[model samples]
Target chain A: MLDSERLATDSKPNILLKGTKEGLLLLLNEVVSFESLLEDLSTLIHGEKKSLFEGPDLKISVDYGERVFAASEIREILDCLAKRENLILREWGPSTAAKLSLFNSSRKFGPQTLLKGTVRAGQRPVFEGDVVVIGDVNPGAEIVASGDIYVLGRLRGIAHAGFLGDWSAIIAAAEFAPMQLRIADIVSRAPERDGKPLRTFMEFAYLKEDSMAVDKLDSLHAWTAMARQSS
Target chain B: MGTAIVVTSGKGGVGKTTSTANIGTALALLGKSVCLLDADIGLRNLDVVLGLENRIIYDIIDVISKDCKLEQALIRDKRFEHLTLLPAAQTKDKSILSPETVKELVGALKELHDFVIIDCPAGIELGFQMAVSGADRAIVVTTPETPAVRDADRVIGLLEKEGIRNPHLVVNRIRPQMVKRGEMLDIDEIVQVLAIDLLGIVPDDETIIKNANKGEPTVMKPDSKASLAYRNIARRILGESVPLLSFEEAPGFWGKMKKVFGAK
Candidate 1:
């Protein structure tokens, strides 16, 4: 926890800031009026907003804490919070802090999945963890996982494997035709519906590889064995 | 858990608005309170397709800008008592509508309606985003032609980008004979290329135009080929497992003649 991130609740279901490993402290309380909460947070942060963090990076994840929020309302809040990240990031991660520290240069979290299902046009799934499938990701379908992703099916829709920007994550699909795939801060688009497809069941994608490489899944048995043995 | 569907396509004149009007009406006939909002703004045509154009005294723009109450802007259809139309403004006031506004409107409307069917425009713009802003899912409508299908694929990608999960695909204007004769794109092929879940496939029928002219959406047109298909789609949206309707029209003249005349 960062020294600057203090915990407070006002003894009510209101906005409270708690900084975690992911960075910007967010205490989401839907009971309080959103406008009043925003006004209060802005006022509280006004004095120390600049010196709040040493680096220009942060992320805010508002958990509704079991409140049933309209999806549109959620979208609105997220869009606004993301803009603040562009101007000044309040979240702090080990990698982010490591980048600023001249000690080392490496990332972690490589365990991921690639799923392939015939995601029908109107079907959508938001996976905040690792996901893997072996079916066609249909058009109009959505996949938003916060971990890693691998699809044995044609990816022609929208997929965001590391939506929260877990930099160690990566995604690899068999045909790789998604309209968009957001892994960490890097987002790659198919550009068009037509593209050359690979027919390999084995492909390895990770931050170490830096690019998606198509191959036989079994070819990386040694890595799998090592990964399994490490645990 | 109610479904929010934005009927959209990349190519114009592919019957997106028509399909939306018909499907919403048909779904309402199934006993769901359906709110069909025209998100096309400047080029709104859903009212015309549903024959509710004259009934619109107020539009979504009116409700948002506080010119009129939301209930007043909602034009209830006499034909299907459960159906209502939040018509698009004929004037240019709706041009400045934002995503948040669209979302809030959808939320307020959804409480009163079971299914909120937004008729999206042909291109990706603020209007289109506004329509999809509150969508939990969607149905991308497309014709069986190359350009339409290609555009559908692109639109599907866009939906994914916008974080719309559970998007169903509807193939409109499909000519089975053309597909069987190797002259048109087939269902499996398009599905393979686009790689999404199939919702309902609608056939190309001449009644579509006639229905549009009468402002009687085809989904409710008793025995029309397209109407039946839209009905099946509504059932699917209601979570019923209806068998996929076959568009493989019985082989044409020469082939049928060959069978009758004992010729190969």
Candidate 2:
């Protein structure tokens, strides 16, 4: 009888509930309307499958694949579960795409953020696209950009370019004495005994062979020209 | 109204209380009416540093709680006629005084004095918040050490976030010999890192400790290097443009003789 009931529920493209070692996994359908999902969830808990959840307390983890659940939508799902006293929500796992979507919705890419004056210690300025600083980035400050990062003055702190994983992005500064550099997924720290005098010329950091490499800014023009000719 | 400057360092043992006592005393010696407010609460040391602990009948908490009048809580300094101290309470914690209460107290003190110097407690907590709430400007004190400069940078960031822009930097306890040996961070390095205007730099002098032990501000001793630095800072605060003092050691007998003979 339980197999037949599961067969009946499997025919519909709605919520899929499966038992695992961690207790129960509830996979909510992404294409179905949220109202219908909630209705189907309530009916399955209170209707024919009621006896299945009648045992001891069972942990339930929700996996909303490619669907971002709003607070109200989550509360509705919780309300549907609250009808059954034995079911407990142990985890909420949102899809990676959905998590990235949430961040993308807040900040738009393509445009640069221009910051004037020094970015002192404890100041972190983050941007979706390129970031241009007109002044110094002092020690302990951080600048993060989804694209390139350009500092007109000293860049002595941490500068993370291509924070969203754009490997083509770069970080350039007038005096490059950074504590750390991150380009895309690559990270590099300044060598110990970095007490050398400030460089006279501008320098930049880019991802080379899956590692961060530094070179004088003059080399970037030639590299870009070569890439343009090759393409 | 008078200006209120809060002396703060995010790290302890960087001489916030000592700087406050000395700066306040230096300002008073310049003929300005100065009120030094000790906001450390349970760990009050500004009074003892000023040697006015025995004269404190009431404290800041007494004034804030209305247990005593503001005038009654202020202890007049024995040496300086224009200097007064509003001691911190010993038993109560910093939570006893809210930022609004401190703002009000500082407002009242500003009306009666030319400068209200608040000695901030260490660390960025409620105590630091309460001390910073009443100040019109800030004086960030730091030593030449890396940790001290880092902490000072953090405090300067917080002060800027609180809308105190262009806060002055006072690099204290600078050992000239170490700086000359390239073993310590020099003034230029610290100023470059902090990117703030240098108000003054106080040299590490044994006389400062001796004077502090004797309940006398180093600024009172006219011959001490630290005293001269503090006086220059006070003069600058009074809108005087004194040149920065070079930390070079005083000339020896031969150097002085060469100068007397007009020889290079």
Taking all chains together, each candidate's TM-score versus the true structure is: 0.56, 0.75
Off by over 4 Å in 1: A1-231, B250-263
- Predicted complexes: DockQ each: 0.05, 0.41
Q: After superposing candidate 2 on the true structure, give the runs of residues whose Cα lies further than 4 Å from its correct spot.
A: A1-109, A226-231, B254-264
RMSD (CA, Å), each prediction: 20.8, 18.5
Candidate lDDT values, in order: 0.72, 0.86
| Best candidate, lDDT | 2
Compared with the true structure, what per-residue lDDT tens digits does model 1 show for residues B57-168?
8888878888888998899997988899998877756655899988998998888988999999888777778888998778988777867876786677678889975678
Return the lDDT, model 2, position A68. Answer: 77
lDDT of 1 at B208: 90
lDDT tens readout by residue for model 2, B1-264? 899999999999988898999889999999999999998878988988888878978888888888889998889899977899999999854455899989999999999999999999999999899999999999999999988988888888899889999899999998888999999998898998888999999999999888788888888889988999999999998989999888888899999999999999
For A1-231, candidate 2 gives per-residue lDDT tens digits of 235775685676587776655677777888778887887788778878878778999887777888878899989888888888888877777643333333443334589889988887788989989999998888888999999999999998899999999887889999888889999989999877467676758999887668877899999887655533343
